[model samples]
Target: MELFFFQLLNGLGLGVIYFLLSVGLTITFGLLNFVNFAHGAFYMVGAYVTFVIVSLTGNFWLALLIAPLVIGTLAIALEQSVVKFSYVLEHKYQILVTLGVALMLQELVIMIWGPIGKNVSPPSSLAGIIEIGDFIYPKYRAFVIAFSALIAIVVWWGLEKTKFGALVRAGSENAQMVGLLGVNITRLFSITFGLGGLLAGLAGVLAAPLRGADPFMGVEALGIAFIVVVIGGMGSFLGALVGGLVVGVMQSVMSSVWPEGASLMVYAAMAAVILSRPRGLFGRA
Candidate 1:
């Protein structure tokens, strides 16, 4: 029972990270009708940036603040220069071009930081364990769960309640109609992309200490993220949240009980979900 509880906490933490990146992909795809394979690259960059900031300033808070801003600003530039043009092309072109961009970004990371990975230790304040009667839990892991839950709530509120959120939703449903209604869709896309990068960047920052700041970490995340997106419903925000948690818990349990079968279990769960629901568990039909 103790093990199960711990796994649940770990799953929640992992789910949040997955949620962060998938949400952006969901919005970008659902709204702009563009395929962005490079989103994971931004996530990788965020971890590296967080590592650098933590090394220089020795301040976790500062790293959190700066990492998202830097990545988001870069995303703004990326959208303006290339992503903007890709919208006119087919999804295949968008995927191919974005994959190229992802490779370029990965290489750029290697050149700047060399061929090794970096690690950022959790803040001094968050280190160690907390005793809860019979079970002791890591404080950092708890923070991961709480932080992710807060972010999920904020994203949900923004999309469901705010005026701008309504605009984004309308555009996603029918961009031509939204644009004709005087909503600036191009600008909105740019903003959404940047915000998406911000979320990915924040994920990087959070995952840095857990997974270490590796150049290839983004590559690792991409697979799981794609699965979560598929299982949760490709364009559904709530789907991403539930899917992430489901995948995370499944991975955690499988890894514990059948380490050798861990990787296969992830795909098995995804396959099961897909087989059961072709449009996704929460996606529109």
Candidate 2:
């Protein structure tokens, strides 16, 4: 079952990327109760940032460092200028505003990078493959798995152990009370939004070499992220992780057996999950 193992590895790699993307969306929704339809567009921007930086300096590592930071700043600015106004509105209104933001960012990317997709090569250091017995794997992909695992650990620690994480959890439960305690809820919202953007950006950067950067990739990424979030349950950290892996593995395995129906299977899986548990696997009632 070398083939199965290969696909499994692929799935895990993809799952981590999905986890990174969905975790940000999950956190923002969990805390601010704000729906960010533009989350995917922010992800696209980060990929573009990596694309641009690598094209200019020929340094994948530098792009990796800078792309997320740039997106984080942009997200913070957008929150202060636009997203903050929607916090008090209904979810529908929030969706509309964020959808508008997504469209704007998509068009902006097209204007700058054109509608064509661009490829990003892995760094020379990770350009080769590792072989064991009869199996082989890409070095960059191996790096993705290890690096993402490290990130996941750091994120868990930050959320469960840090003061900021406590405040975030507290804010999610009772933002009004948190504000009553003089926690500057407005600033927290901005930071939370920025954090979401940062994670989305990081996912984009990591995914660029594997999938490349395209104007429409954000839309697809958004759909996948939503699927993961829905399957795992919104605002549930563990749900996001498990759901991402499940989706990733299913898609990867299906690709070999039913290439055309691979995407359909993801939706089918979601449907199956919904038919049984309406609130999602981990969503609160």
Candidate 3:
């Protein structure tokens, strides 16, 4: 029972990170009707940026602050320069262009950082374990959970309360109408794309301390993000949150119950969800 509880907590922590990863993808889709296959590359670059900052400054906190901004700017630039052109194209062309962009960024990372993975130590303040009777947990993991939950709340509030959020929601429903009303839909699309990149970058920075920064990690993260999106329903914020938690808890618990099949179980859960609700848990039919 103790082990189960421990795994469950770990899973919750992981779920939030997954939420951070996929929310941007979903939001971009929701607002722009565009899918960014290069999002994982943006994530990968964020991790690498963290690695560089921490290595030079020995300050994990600084990396946390700057890396996301860097990736967000880069994403905005990409959108303005190249990605925007593909928006009017079919989904297949969008996929191809973004996939090409992803490949280019991946190679750029390899060229600059080399193929070797680098470990990021948790900040000195969080570099310890918490003990409560027989239960033990990493301090950093706890921080991740608390911090990510805070972010989730802020994001939810922003989306629910802000005028920008209103525009995004309205744009998703009828972008042409929003444009007709003088919303500057192009600028909004750029901002939305940037926001998505920022979130993915944040997720990468948080995850670096846990999994280390690797060139190929983005590919893996991308796959997991897509799975979360599929399970939760594309373009649904609530779905991203619930799907992340479900996937995270299942994977974490399965690691203890069936170590070798943990990865397989993730797919199994997704399959089950799809069989029952093809539109996803919170997605609109």
TM-score of each: 0.98, 0.98, 0.98
Q: What's the true lDDT of residue 153 in model 1?
A: 94
Give the least accurate 10-residue stretch of model 3, judged by summed lDDT. 105-114
**lDDT by residue (tens digit), candidate 2, 33-119:** 889999999889999999999999999999989999999999999999999999999999999999999999999999988999999
Name the TM-score of candidate 1: 0.98
lDDT of 3 by residue, 169-198 (tens): 898889999999988999999999999999
**Which residue pairs clash within candidate 2?**
none
Q: lDDT scores for all predictions? A: 0.88, 0.93, 0.93
CA lDDT, candidate 3, residue 183: 86
* Per-residue lDDT of 238 in model 3: 94
What are the clash counts of all predictions, listed in order? 0, 0, 0
- Model 2: lDDT equals 0.93
What candidate 2 gets wrong by more than 4 Å, as runs, is none
The candidate scoring highest on lDDT is 3
